[model samples]
Target: MTGKLYGVSVGPGDPELITLKGLKAIQSADVVAFPAGKNGKPGMAESIAQTYLQPHQEKLPLELPYVQDPDALTTAWAVATDQLYEHLSRDRRVVFISEGDVSFYSTFTYLMLTLRARDTAIEIQTIPGVCSPLAAAAELGLPLTIWAEKLAVLPLLHNLAELETALDWAETVVLMKVNRYYPQVWQILRSRQLLQNSSVVVRATSNQQKIYADLTNLADLSLSYFSVLIVRRSQQWFNSS
Candidate 1:
């Protein structure tokens, strides 16, 4: 009998943010799998869920490298699929923990798809948690959306034109993976006179979290890979508070 696989989102960085169901899955699973951390350190997902892990549970760190090359990603996912299948085929309940919501730009999606491609009979379940944008909004004491406002969430802006397009139609815009594009993003917001209406949250909801509620003077700021930039088109959102 093959065991079932569970994909659990550990939340945006805070251990306390993990859902009860996600925590239970972590503690009760026979094996816990997470993306292997770089530089010999625990990954974000592992760190957040470590508090609930059992001593007897097997730990599997699958190396899911952060790269854009399709071939490289495919190879890594295939290897991870094999590693997960090894325990599942042996009737060991395996739980793969992911940082933030498992369905929202999380690496677990790729792993799950690869695993499914390997065996269609595999049983899988996913649990959602607080994504970064919502966590960032909470930290900023602002709402992500209100009334009928249109929201746009984008990942890694390949061109500044995309930002222009989002600002054109969306009432609220969230830019993920904003580490390298901070300067350009700042200029765009500044040009549109929306600097004061924008904010940046780094490592949201974590102990090391940093919030920049105003982007007026952050053009040269350096941010981590986990940073997120939120822009509200209506200045009333900022002025009201």
Candidate 2:
């Protein structure tokens, strides 16, 4: 009997944000695995779940590099899948913890896909947790969307035209992983006079979390990889607060 694989979302940053079911899965698992951090530091998922993990549980760090190279990604996923299969073949329950929701831009999705492709008999389950957009909204004390408000969540901006299109249609726009394209984004928002209605939240819910409610003078602000930018077409809600 092959052991089951649990892809648990540990929330954005705060350990307490983890759901009861997710916490239970982590504590009961025979092995706990998370993405390896950069420069030998603990990854965001590991940092959030560390306090709840048991000493007896084997910790595994799977290397899932941040890159756009298809071949490099495929190789890394294959190696990580094999590593998990080794323990799963012996019937050891393995829990792979992700920083945010396992379904939303998560590495766990790739890992799960690779595992299923490798072995059709593998059992897998995913537990949902807080994603960055929701966490950022909470930190900003604003509603992500109101009734009938159209919302668009975009990844890194590869083209400014896409941003223009989103702003034209969506009442609310969320830009994830906006660190690199922040200067460009700032310029666009500035041109459209949306700076006052825009906000930036970095490392939401973490100890080092930073919040910029008014983007009026943040054109040159440098942000980290975990930054999120929220642009609202209406400043009514923001101005009232």
Candidate 3:
């Protein structure tokens, strides 16, 4: 009698943004689960969902070491799955929380894969939440993609060549983690004449939201890793020749 597992997305940072359905799922679960960062600190997802967690409910946290290396991530995921395996085998329901839509660049994906590989008997369900990127665009009142135009959502550390290619072919480009290579991204956008048409959103959907249309301050500004830069209808390719 294996238990059911839920991977719920809590939306971005604002607690009010959590969908009613996700909240109901978490509330009804027997145990709540979340992944902490490399330092073993509590996770943001758990913090956001804390208000809704019952006083008697159990919170299961999986410590995941933050590293880009895939091998290291795999190790952490396997270890974390162990923490939930036993309870799940007993038919105890478990809910794993993640920020934004669980499917989009969330750490929960790794654990989902691990459980599947280990043949965990628990049934898994994922509930969608508004992605920060989408909410960011909404804040700016800018359309991410219009009729028949493709959009690319890319993270920093993506190769410059691939970045350029996406910028070239796509009608709109959403660059996440732009803070990692702010200067480089700025230079690329400026050279391609797309800088003026883009908007940089920091702390999207939160009270401290910042939107910048000017690239003049972009080079000096320090953006959060959660930030996103949206380029819409940017057909300007200076050297399209």
Candidate 4:
């Protein structure tokens, strides 16, 4: 009997936010895997699910470099899949933990895609958890959508073009991974006179969480990589003088 693979979402920052199904998967997994960043440090997903891991369970730290190079990313995914092959061949239950919903801008999707390509018969299950945008919106008391309003969730903003389009097309826009390009993002919003309706949330729902409702201070603020910017195109809930 070949073992199965489980993709578990641990939720955004807060461990208690993890779904019961996700927790059960973590508890029963014989081998636990998480993507270690370029710094080779433990992943946020692992830290969130640490309490659920059994003392004797095996751990796999798959190195995922923080690089935009496609070749490098593909190679890393291949290598990580190769590591999983060894355990799966031996019929060992494996669970991979992801910080947010596995289906949303997560490393687990890459692993699952490669694994399925290698063997189409491979069994995989995914457990969803609270995504960052939802958590951030809750932290700021901002409604993601009202009635028929449209909501767009963009994982990254490489340029201002897409940012402008998002603001124009949707009533609410959630931009994840906005830390690096925040200055530019702020400028674009300020140019369009949309700053008053925008807010930035860092490490939402965590002990280190910070919310910035004033876009004016955004220029001087040093944000974390975990930060997200939510723009209400028409709402003036966060108006700043």
Candidate 5:
């Protein structure tokens, strides 16, 4: 019999944020695979799930390049898929851990695609966890969406014009991977006089978590790679009490 694959979301930053089912999968899996960050650094997913990892489980860190090129991404996913396939071929249960939810802007998505493409009959399961945007909102006591309000969760914005267009009509916008383009985003929000409505959370729910309730005047500030920016068109909904 072939082994099953589990995409376990370890949640954003906080180790305790992992779901019960996710922990069980991690503890019971024969092999645990996580993305190996730049320069062979341990991936965040593995770090978050380290406490639950059993001594008998094999750990596999698959190299994943941090780039936007489709070819590079495909190659990286192929490599990871093959590594996971090695364990599966031996009838060993494999669980690929991921940060945040596996379906949202996660590297596991690409790996899952490649694995399924290789064999459509492969058994795959996803265990959902709390995503960053919601974590940031909860930390700030802000409502992401309410009533008929619209919300947009965008990946790192490269073009200010495109970002302006995307958030112009939406009631709320959650900008993931904001550290790279934060200066530009600050200028855009300032130009639109929406700076006061913007808030930032760095490494939300983690020990290093930092919150910026108002970034109206913060200039040229450097942030960590795990930062997220949330912008509200109107501040009428935030319950700061």
Candidate 6:
């Protein structure tokens, strides 16, 4: 008989941010799984969940690469799918975690799709956790979206093209995955005179959390892919608060 597959979200780096429901899922799961880079030995996601994990059980690590190679991703997913499928056959409940909410641009989404196609009866459950966008709002003490202003969460897909488009109308724009393309994001915001008004947060809600409004010197900095940019139109608004 196939067992349950729980998708848990260990919010940011703060263990306390993990939901009580998520803890229960982890505690009862028979096998805990998380993705890693091809060379990442100990899964970063699993390591983050270690604080809430029981002492005796070791985490099951799945290695998936970040680069864009269709064949490689397919192969890696297949191998991982097989490993997870085997656990289900043994009736071992599995909880796979992502850094933030499991569904939001998480690797768990990829695995979920692959697993679903193969087994129609496998039960899948997801629990939401805190994300960096909200965390950035708290860290910088900024109102993300007030008076029912439109808010857009756009990934730094390729360049600042989408960001430029969003700035034209969005009252609050959260640009996620801004690490590799920091300079690109900064240039567009500065050109629009939105630099000082925005707040850049890396690793929000974690011990490594770094917040800065000084975008002038951010051209050379390297940030995690988990970084986020909270952009508001008015500079005086954040200043007054």
Q: Where does candidate 2 stray beyond 4 Å?
A: 237-241
Q: Write the per-residue lDDT of candidate 5 for residues 1-241, one digit (tens) a residue.
A: 4899999989999999999999998988999999876655667887788888889889999988888899998888898899999888888899999988888888888888898899898899999999999999999888888889999878977677778887777999889989999888999888888888899999889888999989977967799889999998877754543
The TM-score measured for candidate 3 stands at 0.90
User: What pairs collide in candidate 6?
Assistant: none
Residue 86 lDDT in candidate 5: 85
lDDT of candidate 1 over 1-241, digit per residue (tens): 5788999999999899999999888888999999999999999999888888889999999999999999999999999999999999999999999999999999888888888888899999999999999999999988899879999998989988999999999999999999989998999999999999999999999999999999998889999999999998886665666
When summed lDDT is taken over every stretch of 10 residues in candidate 5, the lowest stretch is: 232-241
Worst 10-residue lDDT window for candidate 6 reads 36-45
Tens digit of lDDT per residue, candidate 2, span 1-241? 5699999999989999999999999999999999999998999999989899998999999999999999999999999999999999999999999998999999999999999998889999999999999999999988999868999989878888999999999999999989989989998999999999999999999999999999998788999999999998885665575
In terms of lDDT, which candidate is stronger, 1 or 4? 1
**How do the predictions measure up, each by TM-score?**
0.97, 0.97, 0.90, 0.94, 0.95, 0.91
lDDT of 6 at 48: 70
How large an RMSD does model 1 have? Answer: 1.2
Q: Write the per-residue lDDT of candidate 4 for residues 58-119, one digit (tens) a residue.
A: 99989877779999999999999999877887899999999978888998999999999998
Worst window of 10 by summed lDDT in candidate 4: 232-241
**lDDT per residue, candidate 3, 80-177, as tens digits?**
98887877887898999998889998888888888878775558999999897788878887667756889888866568777788888898888887
Candidate 1: pairs in clash: none
Ten residues in sequence with the least summed lDDT for candidate 2: 232-241
Comparing 2 with 6 on TM-score, the higher-scoring candidate is: 2
Clashes of each: 0, 0, 0, 0, 0, 0
lDDT of 6 by residue, 22-77 (tens): 99999888788888634534555665788777866547888777867899988888
The C-alpha lDDT values of all candidates are 0.92, 0.93, 0.81, 0.87, 0.88, 0.80
